[model samples]
Target chain A: MMKATVYVTIKQGVLDPQGVAVQGALHSMGFEEVSSLRIGKYMELQLDTNDRAEAEQRVKAMCEKLLANTVVEDYRYELEG
Target chain B: MMKATVYVTIKQGVLDPQGVAVQGALHSMGFEEVSSLRIGKYMELQLDTNDRAEAEQRVKAMCEKLLANTVVEDYRYELEG
Candidate 1:
């Protein structure tokens, strides 16, 4: 089996309200040293195939078509077997 | 300045509804090669201080106190300056 780890994050210049809220909550909890925070998504997938190239291609297609909003978010993935 | 990347994932045995929904969507989209999928949270933090040890300590505390729900999620972080 092949395993893929994908990260999906908002593009720069995007306003992340959830991140802002979490930062505020942290500060309120007295974690004053936190300067900035951004929150994103992490996904793990297990694929049946062992072909690295095929896995990579399929994973990329998955990210583009369903896992990420390419216009507002950027995604990168790592694969391992 | 320092940057920290934190990954928060649902603990084993925990049911992840969002992950299930995404997996279902992927299968519907014909990515049937995907055997399993899990989703979690990714966070980036920029801190004002550069001390590696202090940063690690603070980040750990932040994760335990705010960034993750220890009851259902486990968090790990990497730091860079």
Candidate 2:
């Protein structure tokens, strides 16, 4: 078996209202030291095969095809057993 | 500085189109043993202070406000140095 972890995040230049809101909440909660907050996504995938080369290729294809929005989001993954 | 990591994911029973698309890509890549795939978001925030209690509160605030879409997405976080 193989395991993979994928991370997806919006591009830095894009506006993130949710992140902003959280920052505001933090500040209101007496956490005035927080400056910047950005939010993104993480995923774990398990494959039934042990072939590392094939697993990597499939994992990349999965990220490009569905795990991430290529226009506004970027994705990277680490694969292991 | 205090660091917080936020993870956002669609709740169970909700449709995950991106995850489905990834499953397709994985199947095409010849690793047919894959069954289920779920995609989500990940974020890391660096607070300007080292106070753990305040930092946790702030981080949680961030998660509730803008780090996640509470209606459809679920969020969890971890704080570290």
The C-alpha stretches of model 2 lying farther than 4 A from their native spots are: B8-32, B51-81
- lDDT, residue B23, model 2: 77
Q: Tens digits of per-residue lDDT for model 2 on B29-71?
A: 7657787778887777888978899878767776787567888
Instruction: Report model 1's chain A TM-score.
Output: 0.98
Estimate, for each residue in A14-77, the C-alpha lDDT of model 1 and write its tens digit: 9989999999998998887788899999999999999999999999999999999999999999
Pairs with steric clashes in candidate 2: A18-B66, A22-B62, A40-B41, A40-B42, A41-B40, A41-B41, A41-B42, A42-B40, A42-B41
Error in Å for residue A5 of model 1: 0.5
Chain A TM-scores, per candidate, are 0.98, 0.94
TM-score of 2: 0.68
Show model 1 residue runs off by greater than 4 Å: none
- lDDT accuracy of residue A4 in candidate 2: 88
